[model samples]
Target chain A: MSDEVKDPKDVLICRCEEVTLREIEQAIDEGFDTVNDVKRITRAGMGLCQGRSCSKVIARIIAQRTGKNIEELLQNSYRYPVRPEKFKIFDEEESHE
Target chain B: MGMSTAYYLTLQGKRVLILEAGIFGAGASGACDDMILFQSKKPGINLELAFESLELYHALNVDLKHDLGFENYGGMVLIKDQKELEIMEEFVQQQRMYGLDVVMLDEKEMRKRQPHISSRFIASTYSPMDAQIDPFHVMYGFFHVAKNLGLEYRKKTPVVGIEKQGNGDFRITTQSGEVFEATQVVNAAGTWAGEIAAMVGENVPITPKRGQIIITEKIPMVGETNLWSAEYLVSKLRPEVKTEISEEHKALGLGFAFTRSFGGNYLIGSTREYAGFDTRTTMEGVNAIVKQAVSYIPLLKDIHFIRAIAGLRPSTPDGKMILGEHPDVPGFYTASGHEGDGISLAPITGKLLSDMMCGAPSDSRLEELSPVRFAVVKGEQVQ
Candidate 1:
């Protein structure tokens, strides 16, 4: 009844670049406290899916442990540019007055 | 210059190019309440401009002959308190000064005019001239007309890079590694105009303001008079009171407003979040919007929410437009950052931008809407 839940070593959340539970725990041990900070250290959120896969688990873990409101905590991060432009086209016609 | 600038430019002779970062009207111009009403703007010039624009919309509806879906279904703005009623009354005086005919109606009058509204409202201001339009139809109207008139447009291209050449023309670079040499460029990139300006060493403080909306399924009396809270519109203009939502006013909230668009799609908006380029709707935001909107029109309680989306309005440090030619740049002109009013004033902007770029005389009203003011401030800031 008094046992701590051990994080599954093989459980992986961020599949794009292959981040595992052990790695997340290691970053947590290294004082990367917030979801943003953990993502920065481990690149957990900067994958093809852009944190969508790992954010919820990481947010829940942080919220439960940190005693923060999960709903409010989830709203903390800012999403930007929405689209990463791989290409753009412009012309001198548009550049001129 | 006359509207002939756009006409003649397309007519004659030069390669008339329109720089669209996306599909025509895909930007903030397409994303607005599309209220052509002067219900909430300051009296005097602002209301006059909105009313005149409303009239222009009406005229265009007749001239364009049903293509634009120009609507004149009359708008009703509900007021929950006399404080709001006072503002409408004051604005009426100013609208009268601008030759606008507005009616200051009481609760009974308002209820008679728009019975769908909840009786809790103290009063409502109905501008007989207020109207709506299908934004897509109107924008497509412009694009279709422009296209048929032989104006060339490039899509999915951003004017990211620019070089001022010795010939006093511009060499603009697209993200696609394509460069085009054009003698004139119009910075109508909507919310992204500031970033576009930066490519040309021009600084435009075009801040992107995210306005989100929730559409409710067609439910009768959910509201009428294009119902909106006067407090929301007022708070939007006054900085000190902008976000100040008292505990009592939580039902209304800050910057909270709504407008029932045509087509049975209620355009309930908006929360002005400064979330740059994040168009995704958050549950918190949607919930807040629904809560506030329902509070104003309790009838909305029964209405089911269909969907939620967001549009970024290009808001300047000052709330007005940054139009006209670049003050220092020899050949660059801009018509951007009308913020939430972009849709309301697009025709005027397009007309004025064409006039200014052709190096001809412009309407005096154009001066009030010039980007040169932003340019001058940019000049001072950069120095």
Candidate 2:
């Protein structure tokens, strides 16, 4: 399966952020194994989707590379406003309530 | 703070070990923005140390062999009214005398640099010296390099107790009941520095100032340089200049700092509230920050904010970082209470603390930043 892609750099894991598999691998090689660490260094999951799209794939990649259990790796915290939110919404009269 | 100090110590050929209460970058180091601002600093030791720190960052970018994401993206402090302009003009003059390349820009110049800025801002102060670096990269760069140089670290090992042994060595007990001994112990704990100092019977007044920042989705660059409002600085520098500030804004301690990250997201911030140790992002803070940011750059109003992060900045009473050895506690040192300037001053703090520990001839100017200022001398507190 790994041989299917001759170059990990060509594999785009995070479509929202346009992060490639090679970038994630490089981050892991540099000792940023956790999803959050890689997310910070590579911006793989910090985009419009906020890791919803690429976190699992990145975790699997880390697990495969680092030989760590997928469950053992701490996941990034799920933050508020589950979807993308506009700044004006907060200023709305209803949001204040 | 601990990691960078450890890195510097390792560079000095000292056997260093770091005991962290949590994982790396779990605290303010990870949660804060990447600004290494110069305009925000008062023209004093803080500014002096910031200049030295920026130089060190350039060297570290090469020495660490990693992209620290260091960028010389200049900064601007927007002035809203005649009152703010008056204060900022004097402030800029003082900074200019201190060798900072800063200038007061008219509304035309400000708009030429930041087209998205609201027309309400009458003027701004621009400084090309203002810069930023990715905190995570810098932190981990120190960690990896120092580890390669024989530095050891134990994550999740919170120091539960500290005691001086009869043999003059310091004994440290971790939360996991592990014991370690060292001849010298440096308290590089951020907000928890006070607690760590108390364990050794030293007094260090470090409070946690909660700063909340919101992240926007990847978008086009709104301005040429990082942005800050003189309104916040006015309130801090000249409290006599009465301006209509909302109760919500006051409570949240809302301010504006807008910077685009390497990944192209605008890291808009922030609030400065004395919320103790609560690092939770409040709805009020997020709303205030968004409103303040939109007021400065109306283009941000339509942007989608994806996440809100809060960090507890280790604030001191005087706003200067506490560095140097305790007066009575020999072999004990502290390098904390940097508050918002932690990222800006991390490298210099580490180098200076390491130099102090190594008994190297140090700068006399650093005497002003000593922890001895907070020490109780003969039942009389020293200012």
Candidate 3:
């Protein structure tokens, strides 16, 4: 909430995708307004871990850059199998037949 | 829908083989919030189809002999403000026109029905037709019965290619190089229907509208009926209507829908984002869902959201489903693009498609649902 200019490049924004603050800032500068928008353009929150690990960090960076509350930023919806599961589970269940 | 179609097809003494691109219920069918509520439908054919589907759900467990974990505990739509309450007044009238048994409840009556609902709600609507089921179990039951009746289903066998044979039959190939020739090919591919149609040289306008849901850890029951916000009705039924809150919520694609699973866990959702195929969850989506849920049910603030998942509702340009045969492709038919209503409309879709394939009297609804409704053959405007 302070006006002190800090280096956005020094920090990591999305740990899941290994996206840095500099990349996130560049994504914002390129006209990505929302968190989901930045994630799509820069792959900041899209990763194997499903963004649960680093989405908040990315949101905060966007909130700071946009001078808006983090609540105003849009979040990407999570996809299925919240964690990784084997595809063989699909085949394994059929063996019950 | 595919499994149910197989069940009906087998009953009509036809050889049926189901080729699933993934495990059963792995798509929208599995990821739904288990709302079989008639209150959600718009009036006219939509409500009539929903009422018909409700009747089918009543008989599905007995017919399948699978129990299905079905429950008719009823449901409620929470109205947060006067604007949303006004919308519900008209929505309830439309539902009533279709003979739905629903009653509007003020804060006192609503509180009597579900005391845990936050005091912010001015009114609510309750309906007995609103119910819940384990979506996976429903498909599994259909598959189990259809299988016993000599139906063959192959999971993970996606249709990689669909070539029209000279004899007017279709040769379907899987990703693993397995091939089979069929007299007719049904495309019940759900959200992937667009891609499947492309394989057969057809274009179906299906957008993967991503919806996110959160499952809280199981606990003692908080309310007796499934609860959704009137905001949800506006979002689903009338997204173009704008207000200050609705406009703000639209940015996050947040609509408040919540239901308790049969196991006592709360399944809270859901955000409608046109994010293409990216189903991964975002921090803002989760936060907005939590904020919407806790705003209506303050008690949920303490609950732990143990799991989060998303499903792509196979949305069409218009809200109606895409069904029936390809106009140009002789043996190719489609039964996909049910969107959020896939779970509710599955039985009806299956029965309808089966009747058409059996050369029986096609349900009048097929006239509207046919894939040619998009009219790519005539090279006309796409709906």
Candidate 4:
């Protein structure tokens, strides 16, 4: 796990952002610092699907680099209205339906 | 006011109730880019509070035992011209004086860090203190922890009316004929704070400032750092500052800002318009973001936009949050008017409001954020 993420040409870790392991390593090499740093610079996890797609791979890369266990790594916060529902659904009479 | 306040209150062993018009993260909290930055904050209590919140964010995941995807990506404010360089120079001085860890990055150094940055930028300022979090997870974590501590939540409930009882209690009637009784009512509603305050016959000079965002298809890290134009600071603090940008764009409050989301999408935005509660995304706003963002990071021009979105930020005329109890209404309190900083300020907002509600001495900073400040500012005779 530690040495596996060094290759920048690795397969897409995040398809939504189109981030690769190589770019993640470059972000870290360029002093991007933390997992969130790589996410901000390379967008490894910031995607339309909201990282449900690629966070695990990105986390694995981060764990490999930082020498931290994958389980110990920080995950992104979740927001409410977590489900996508239109405002019309909240209308008093409409909500009943 | 509702969720975070409930969290701290429940922790204090108090009975708590939460009523949401929609599900959590539905409002500004969910829609905002998860940046907890202090560089552009209005240099006094706002920066102080942001610093406190930054500390809270650092420990929050560990404290709540939830994964909040917190990271210090650092932030860079681009200086596109000599005027902007001067402005950033002064701004950096003020920020440093306020104990912020900010350093000026010349064009060469800035380019070294963020190679994709435009050559049009002469200089920039970098701060490691700026960071991002997944707003959805933050809210979810807070709600989960609060609920476990005995917080009661009723979703799909909208307050239709408010009546004051003879004993100083407030009775809130939801649209579905549900009634909620409480000794005090805190208006933590985002853009709807004004309407909530009006229900108690109080005025909280809050407005809905619409901010539009554009999300790009996942691509390699084209730009480094959470980037913003020095104009963003100018627009937020002194809207009158003149720039070569069109009056139309200026009116829309367009400024360049781009950050990578945890999901790999680049969330670039935004435009601030007083759209009277309308949260719809406009072509003009989205176009401005695209034009300005591509100008700073030319690589963005080749990328396709995945989605265009907008959110209504709760803003005050004076650009400060309104916390504490309303001056006239005994138990009717306010914890709104955070503007774009709401996501960053939620933790402290909740704790401070809860402290006041629990009969603890008010934080001296709360004195300035008093709901009464607006009254004093207007010199309006409180009837």
* Candidate achieving the largest DockQ: 2
Per-residue alpha-carbon lDDT of candidate 2 for residues B1-383, written as tens digits (9 for 90 to 100): 89889999999999999998876788899889999999999999889889999999999999999888888889999988888888899999999999899999998998999998888888999999999999988987898899999998776789999999899899999998999999999998898999999888788999899999999988887779999989889999988878788887888888888998867888989999989899888888887888878777887778899989999999998898999998788999999999999999999999999999999997899998999989876666433
Each model's lDDT comes to 0.63, 0.88, 0.77, 0.77
Q: Considering lDDT, where higher is better, how would the candidates rank from best to worst?
A: 2, 4, 3, 1
Interface RMSD (Å), every candidate: 18.7, 1.6, 15.0, 12.5
Candidate 4, residue A58: lDDT: 68
| Residue B318 local lDDT, model 3 | 82
Name the Cα RMSD for model 3: 15.9
Instruction: Say which prediction, candidate 2 or candidate 3, comes out ahead on lDDT.
Output: 2
Q: Fnat per model, in the order given?
A: 0.00, 0.75, 0.04, 0.07
**What is candidate 2's TM-score against the reference?**
0.93
Per TM-score, the best of the predicted structures is: 2
First chain of model 2: TM-score?
A: 0.80
Deviation of model 1 at B371, angstroms: 2.5
- Candidate 3 lDDT by residue in tens digits, B134-212: 7766876787678778998776678899899888888989999999999998888888888888887788889898898
**What is the iRMSD in Å for candidate 3?**
15.0
- Of 1 and 4, the candidate ahead on TM-score is 4
Kindly give the number of clashing pairs for every candidate.
Answer: 15, 0, 7, 25
Query: Residues B158-206, candidate 4, lDDT per residue (tens digit)?
Result: 8888888999999999999988899988898888887877777788877
Off by over 4 Å in 2: A1-4, A7-12, A17-33, A61-77, A92-97, B377-383
